[model samples]
Target: MSAYPTDRQPTHTPVMLSEVLALLNVRRGGVYIDATVGLGGHAAAILEASAPDGRLLGLDADAQALAAARRRLEPFGERCRLEQAWLDHCAAAAARHGFSAVDGVLCDLGVSSLQLDDPQRGFSFQQDGPLDMRLGDAAEQTAADVVNYYEEADLADVIYRLGEERRSRRIARAIVERRPLETTGELAQIVQSAVGRGPRRRIHPATHVFRALRLEVNRELERLSGFLASARGLLAAGGRLVAIAFHSLEDRIVKRFIRAAGSGDDAGFRSLSKKVIRPSADEIQRNPRARSARLRAAEAV
Candidate 1:
């Protein structure tokens, strides 16, 4: 297990925290689940709001994150259970921890601040680190493996399809020419050179490519889709299922899933929000990362 420092607290700020608490409707004696409880920001709040006898199950794929969460939530005693598991295994983990039927389930999807802020994790472009971007230890392949070994055509396809980059072909060609890349800084420089570092660019030139590799390395979309298919099974009647997605790809999946699940007369679930929820200007100022977050909610019928 990765050792997290206890001298100082983690700097993770839970996105739309108030909104999540409201949507979950946490109450005393109720049970809840944080499907991606990074650093236990949301989990701690959930436990506090559902005070007295409420219980929570926190699941995460990253061992380092779980360690941090365990420390942060230790004050809650046995009211919360932390597990090192992915979103897809939430149901099984919940069941194992006596949370078979929960009052709420929250999935905060995509890469987290915990991963991005750590230079050694290689999830950021700002810092130079190894090209490894595996969110979970179980993942055998890393971003290095993908960029160093994938065929140009396949790499282009991954960047185009997953990253939604229009110049994926050009980027892939550049990457192919620079094989055996071992560090994030090296890859970022190559991409910037190939794509041109124009002043007009709103975001970094390598943003799309890095996001593509992270998604592919973690298989986030595939696992999210599978988790959503059976998510309702873990909820009790009227229990809310809330998701916070950081990117367009993840937001689209959540939007479509809730829409489809809530349709028809005999639907098992109903959409709680007709429109997507976003952070306030104050929130954006405090934590710039919350600017891209989109929240969608549904309730089991």
Candidate 2:
């Protein structure tokens, strides 16, 4: 396990925290789940807001994150339960922890700062590290595998579909020509060289490519689909399910899931907000990472 300094706290400021609490309607003594509880930021807040006896089950794929969460939430004593697990396993974890029919479920999807800031984890191209982007320790494949082993055509498809990059073909060709790439910096350089620097580019040219590799390595979309399919069944009647998604792809899934769930008379949920909720300007100023967050919520019928 990665050891973090006890004196220093996790730098990740939970995105749209107030909105998440409001959407989940966290109440005293309520049972809740933070399905992607990285560093226990949101879980800590939930426990505090819920006060006295509110119980929480916090699950995360990364053991390092769970360790940080453990230290951060220790003050809550038995009020918070931390588990090292992926989003897809949330239902089983909830049931085992005696939290079935939970009052609310919050899924904060996509990469957390803890993963990105750790250069050794390779979630970002900005900081050089080994090409290992597995969100959890057990992933069979790594970013290195995707870049070095995938056929040019297959690589292009992954970048295009997951990263939504229009120049995926060129990027993939460049990467194949560079073969056996071993580090995040090497891959980022190849992508930047292929795509070239554009005028007034708001972000790095290699940003999307890195995101695509991380997503593929982690099977993030597949896990998210599984979580969405099962999360509603874990909620009690009138219970809420809130999801905060960072990118368009993730936001689209949450939007569609909520819409589909509320479409039919027999559907298990009803939409709580017709429009997506976003962080306030002040919050974005405080934490720039909050800029892309979009929250969608629904209540179980």
Candidate 3:
């Protein structure tokens, strides 16, 4: 059922595919960039819609994801160019690939299903694995380093500021009490014990803690801010910029950046949607991960 090769194909679906393509206004011969092209699902669709002449430059932080993307996008031959790099370097990568000004730029922010499903990557607490949560090999620190080395106050601050966890102090105290935490399972158990697991709870007790560590480990927020600043320059006049953010922190950044870019005398963009776009109920049912996706679009002025 997948367009990718049968061997080692990633199982993730592209979230809000229709909306992204529509908002991008993809057309034949148009050049585009997928700033976080995880697994190439959206890239493939964009390539297909663009038909014979459309060219795409796909960038990703994970080498493994880039490998999968390379295989999936190989059918398009020279029409697609992929680079293993973080979102923040999209403009540089685009320039290197001769895509200085593109018709559209898509940034599907946050961890992809490929990273979360792989226990070794340690983005989730559902399975036991190393505490490393770096999105790519370029990152210096891992979740283990943050959990085991940071002081209680610093840890609590990170959790509270990034994860917006109300019980960050309690959670940080618990983590400090159990120092030198090595695995995801160990960390998850400690947090659950500290937070008190209840049958009525909607999500795991350690969800925010894990999210915080991953974000901190990867410096995702900082990189996202940098990328947004460069995105306006990367787009040609009338070009579209489509961003899909998974959590409030990321969504809030995108919302404010677009709002500011669309106003004032130096106005560079015009927001395409008055309201944030969310996945349809059917999409959420098909892929539960789609439920949290928030899509925002703007056109370069």
lDDT of 1 by residue, 23-134 (tens): 9998998899999999899999999999988899999999988888998999999999999998998888887888876899999987677788777889999999899888
Per-candidate clash tally:
0, 0, 0
TM-score per candidate, chains pooled: 0.97, 0.97, 0.97
How accurate locally is residue 239 in candidate 1, as Cα lDDT from 0 to 100? 97
Per-residue lDDT tens digits for candidate 3, residues 54-157, read: 99999999887888899889999999999999889888898899997789999998887778887888888999988998878899999999999998999999
**Cα lDDT of model 2 by residue, 160-255, tens digit:** 999999999999999999999998999989998999988989899998998898889888988888999998889999999999998999888888
By descending TM-score, how would the candidates be arranged? 1, 2, 3
* Clash pairs detected, candidate 1: none
**Model 1 per-residue lDDT at 209:** 93
**Scored by Cα lDDT, where does model 2 land?**
0.90
Best-performing candidate as measured by lDDT: 3
How does candidate 2 fare on TM-score?
Answer: 0.97
With a 3 Å backbone cut-off (N, CA, C), the pairs that clash in candidate 2 are none
The RMSD (Cα, Å) of candidate 3 is 2.9
